[model samples]
Target: MKLYTHPDCEKHEMPGHPERPDRLRAVMQRLSESGMLDDINVELAEEISDETLAMVHPPDYIEAIKAAEPEEGLINVDPDTYMNNGSTRAAKLAAGACLQAVQDVLCGEEKRVFCATRPPGHHAELASAMGFCLFNNIAMAADYALRDERINRVAIVDFDVHHCNGTVDIFKERPEVMVCSSFQDNYYPNRYLDYTNEHMINLPMAPGSKGGEWRKRVEREWLGKLEDYKPDLLLISAGFDAHKDDPLAQIEFDESDYEWITQQLLNIAEKHCAARLISTMEGGYDLNALADCAEQHVRALI
Candidate 1:
């Protein structure tokens, strides 16, 4: 497994925000302290070009995001999304890191890759930014893989506490991509598209739901769908906020649960795509829990 990270990812920040730089900092520090950092291949992320950003975002939307960057202080792009001086670059790098992860895994440089960049991108739409996300990183990576990697299909499995409304918006109609998202139903960003489309599998869990329910849903819903699709690549919207210890949502998952889920996904990956997988960080507010749970997720990958 390869781990892609960048210090600049911590530059996109707002004061006292739940989605702040300290989250990634804590994750990295904990990985180092736990000696997990020494076990995997670590690579610094490269800056993404405008052409790459255009793969998913339109020119106008990209320009608007760049124009929103403040010269000094913070500027609000949405009610929750904000941009500082370093935000635009950080957002590009975050998205680019996902692309790099895909390139590494598909070209046989690594069988699996985990991106630890920040400014979680699942909630950012094609034309707009939301939920503290500026650019839809995972969606862009999926697009890149299909277009450039000579892969027929890709499966995106999102376990964020909140729904990946942006990613669904991007590929809802594309049959070549299958997106399975399990989020707390009627929670933040409550408005969601109907899951009538064959490619979209939305698993809505209620508050207080435990890992047993999540595991059952994966076994019952995801495994069969994935078997039918037989995707060439497995992309994960890896969010740790579903943990019981996280303050963002009320889903009860422990570090072991993350490990278990990763193993389950790896089983499907091994059967379908020779274990080609790439995961990018999403939402995880509680630092301690995020660090510990992310470690376990990576441990499973190795």
Candidate 2:
């Protein structure tokens, strides 16, 4: 697996926020200390174009965010989202990292890629910004895969503790994209993924559910639909916030659970496609657990 990250990723932040710079720094440092970072290729991602981001987000919304980048201090865009001077570059670079990862996989340069940048982007809606996300990186990456690369079917599996309301909203009406999200029900950004098109699958787990419960739903729902869709590529909104130690959610998931799910997705990818997978950072608040668990998740990609 190839890796893409940027220093600007740390530049976007809010004081005492959960989505802080240390999240990326922790993961990167752990991967390095684990020796996994040395075993793979690394690339510094560039900025994605406005048009590429606009593929999923509206133009006015894009301009609003770009225009919101403050010259001095932090600007609160929403209850959860904030922008410092470096936010615009950070968000663009995050999206660009996913773009490069997808292109790399489709071009056969790598079997898979993990995008390790911030701020997490699952809760961001198409025309709205919330949940510490400025843009829909994974959704835009999927759109980039479909429109520019001509990939027919792509399955986005969001394993975050929160529902990917943004991704679902973007692809709810389009059959070409299939989105399966496992989130904590009755939580912030409550489940709203609904459409008769049969393109979106939103599974909200109970607050106290553990890995055992998660496995059942994925086995019964996600794997079956993914196999049926026969996606040309697999993209993961890989959020480790479901870990037991995360403060944002109450679900209990260990690193073994993350490894298990990654293997399951890899199996489907190997069976249907050429083992091409692109995953981006979404959520994982606990520094220690997030770092350790993310290390295990990336190990599966290798």
Provide the overall lDDT of each model, using Cα atoms, as 2-decimal numbers. 0.90, 0.89
- TM-score top scorer: 1
Model 2 misplaced regions, further than 4 Å: 148-150, 191-197
Clashes of 1: 0
Query: 60-149, model 1: which lDDT tens digit per residue?
Result: 899988988989999999999999999998999899999999888778899999999988999998888999999999998899999864
Model 1 regions lying over 4 Å from their true place: none
- State TM-scores per candidate: 0.98, 0.97
Per-residue C-alpha lDDT of model 2 across residues 1-302, encoded as one tens digit per residue: 79999988999978898999999999999999999988889899899999888778889999999998999999899987899999999999998999999889888899889999998787788898888988889988888888755589989999999889888877888888899999888887864833324668877898889999899989997888899999988999999999999999999988899999999999988987789899899999999999978988999989
RMSD in order of candidates = 1.0, 1.3
Candidate 2 C-alpha error for residue 249, in Å = 0.7
Pick the lDDT winner. Answer: 1
Clashing pairs in 1: none
In candidate 1, where is summed lDDT lowest over 10 consecutive residues? 189-198
Quality of model 1 by C-alpha lDDT: 0.90
